[model samples]
Target: MVPAERRTMSPALRRTLVIAILVELAVGGWLLASRVLRVPPALPADMVDDPLLAAEIRALASRADRGGTPEWRTLGEGLLGQGAYAHAESAFARAAALAPQDIDALFGQAFCIDRTGRMAASNPLYRRCLDLPDRTEDGVGRKPFALYAIGRNLLRLDDVQGAEAAFRENASFLPAQFQLAKLLVRDGRLGEAVRIVDDLLRQLPLALELHQLKARILEAAGAPAEAFLARAMEERSAHLVESNFSTDYVRPFTTRLGMPRVLQEVESRLPPVPGDPRRDPAVLEREIQPLEALVAEARVPQRATLAFLRGALAADVDDVAGITAALGIVDAAGDRSASRLELEALVRDRMGDAVTATALRERAAAMAPSPQLHRRLAEESERRGDHAAARHHRARADFHLGKAAYRRNRLEDALREFREAAVHDDRHVATWYRTGEMAYHLGRRTEAVEAFRRVVDLEPDHER
Candidate 1:
């Protein structure tokens, strides 16, 4: 963890401070010149506009001055909610001085400090808050939110492992898990991200974001059909009017001459495999050759993806030169996405430059903060014997590619993308609604109804 003295202020905090400084500058020195020593702090009208909150602050201040029981803690909490962090911190400090054992005062103080961009200084107070005795139910001895603050602070410090540990310490806290998942994805450890999100979904089945995340993971893992199913669930969970498209296991196409149908036509013309045909490498290569040739001959920009696919086929056949040639074409076509980086890393790895390969992989992983990337990074890092880094980068990827598919109105492709996105971010109500709409359009009433039910469950006020 970064020590307070060594930790640099975050950009957001710096920006906030700069804005405040600029406002003070604009107001000139009159305010500062008029200030008195120990001037009684007044509530900012915008923050303490509500009558009840204003009254509560006034009452607490009066009680504190009279040496009454420390109702100042309650006032602190009210001020904190109103974004009056400085006043809240003072109130909490007073309450703590009056009642040393008041855990709420310690937590409130730490929370206020943290919110005011003094995270490093707040660390010790957080520890003190958590160390207090358990007075609430759940018997954890500390408020779960304390762990959340600790996790967020650790994350800001780039202490990925520490953040993960803190987040896992309080499993019921959703934001911690989400943060951990993001770190995992950024590090390219998709499998672990999937497991974390999957477990969370079991508890929060109606969470649209989680489902969307899972879908994205599936897509990154090359499970298009599974992604499609996930998208269906996500769409069904949305609050929008659902579509009626049936879920199909086909890539979306602009023309009626869709890839799936075209592939079927080509398959009918090819010689049948005698045994386990799908596993026949030679046959697969032969089948893919025509597509490769077509892609090479085509002048269309979108066909660049076909070149990348051909590179994958070459890799499967251990055709290093073929992979290089195909990838070179993709590069020449000006593709620089995470997928392109991943392919470059793979080729470098194959060429026996382990160091360069690993670096490239890391770069690719960093470029795409997805579950799939993290999973791939984990695999690569584990291969290089860096289990800790591998473990840290194991979150799921999102279904951006699938969303692209969806945008083209390629119902089947869109469904797959939405499903993949939902897997990673199940709380994505939009995806769930789209899935339901598509399912309904395809006359899959049962599936549509199930998806619609999820939507209703997620958003009780959702219109059908």
Candidate 2:
């Protein structure tokens, strides 16, 4: 970790400070001739206008001056919630000084410091919170959050293994679990990531990001049907008109709990073993019953998924008529989603109907810009001598690739990708912001500032 004394401030913080300095210089340049500059002393709750809140703040201050840990801790929590980090830090410090064993005070102080982006300084303070006895702050346990904070700091410091270990220890904490899964994905531990994501979905089935992430991971793992199901889940999560309460083996599209292995066996097309049960037409037809039942009972995404799986199983047994019938239903189900369309396209492509598959895929790509799909489209477009279309698809692919690289702390690669993305998609705020962030990390200050200025120009309210 970079020590406070030697650590350089992040680009966003530096830019803010630089702008403030310039404003000060501009205002003071002529005014200095007449009188010395006098800065106003920042006071706690100075501008608070809500009568109840202001009175409460005053009361907290009064009690804290004469009282101990609880009063100061309460005041600190209040200030922290209001984004008054400096005042909160002081309050928490006073509380910790009076009662060093107060986990709340220690955590509050460390958290206030962490919010300022001084992770190196706050890391040890979080460790201090842990060094003491395990305790609860307010109504929640502190250990999990503190461990998560430590892992976050470790990741920021580029201590990948340390972060992984910390996250592993704090697996029950959702943030820690998410980080661990991301790390596993970065390391190409797809099996591990698959399990983690499955568990996370069980807890938070409606998390759109997790579904999207699983889609990407499954796609990368060469499980297109399962990936498509993940994308289907992604679409379902977005509406959230109804909560998805189902989770577990019965949940569709899981790798271990579902049928990626069976699908893999079918897709491999190796000579069947003499008595392989899956290759038996009778057994395959029997397996189709449960899937047919599932399709009947399930909704758009899951119904589509079950139909596709049934088709795959029927195809494995060379039941051409059965496969065609099942796939026809799969094609009709989940028609509103790109995932369903993509899955249908993949099946059609596998069945040698390239023309129809291409059309469906192109439409799906337009709906949701999948990096892998875009990359394939870019290749196909280039083959068709459509340079402009290829470039556009390639640029989108580059942006997402940069994001993946950034997630893994591969900063140099991320910078390259974002720089390329910036060249193609200059009007996009996300591209500029990503470009600026990567440039700043890679020590290209001028480029970073220019990209940041472009982002600000595009979206004046954008911060970081």
Please give the CA lDDT of all the candidate structures.
0.65, 0.71
Indicate the TM-score of model 2. Answer: 0.42
Question: Where is the poorest 10-residue window by lDDT in model 1?
Answer: 241-250
> Please, what are the lDDT tens digits per residue for candidate 2 over residues 151-179?
88899899999999998998677768887
TM-scores for the candidates = 0.42, 0.42
RMSD in order of candidates: 27.5, 29.0
Minimum summed lDDT over a 10-residue window in model 2 is located at 241-250
Model 1 stretches astray by more than 4 angstroms: 1-56, 137-142, 238-464
Error of 1 at 291 (Å): 74
The per-candidate count of clashes, in order, stands at 72, 0
Candidate 2: where are CA atoms >4 Å away? 1-45, 136-139, 238-464
Cα deviation of 396, candidate 2, in Å: 33
lDDT of 1 at 297: 50
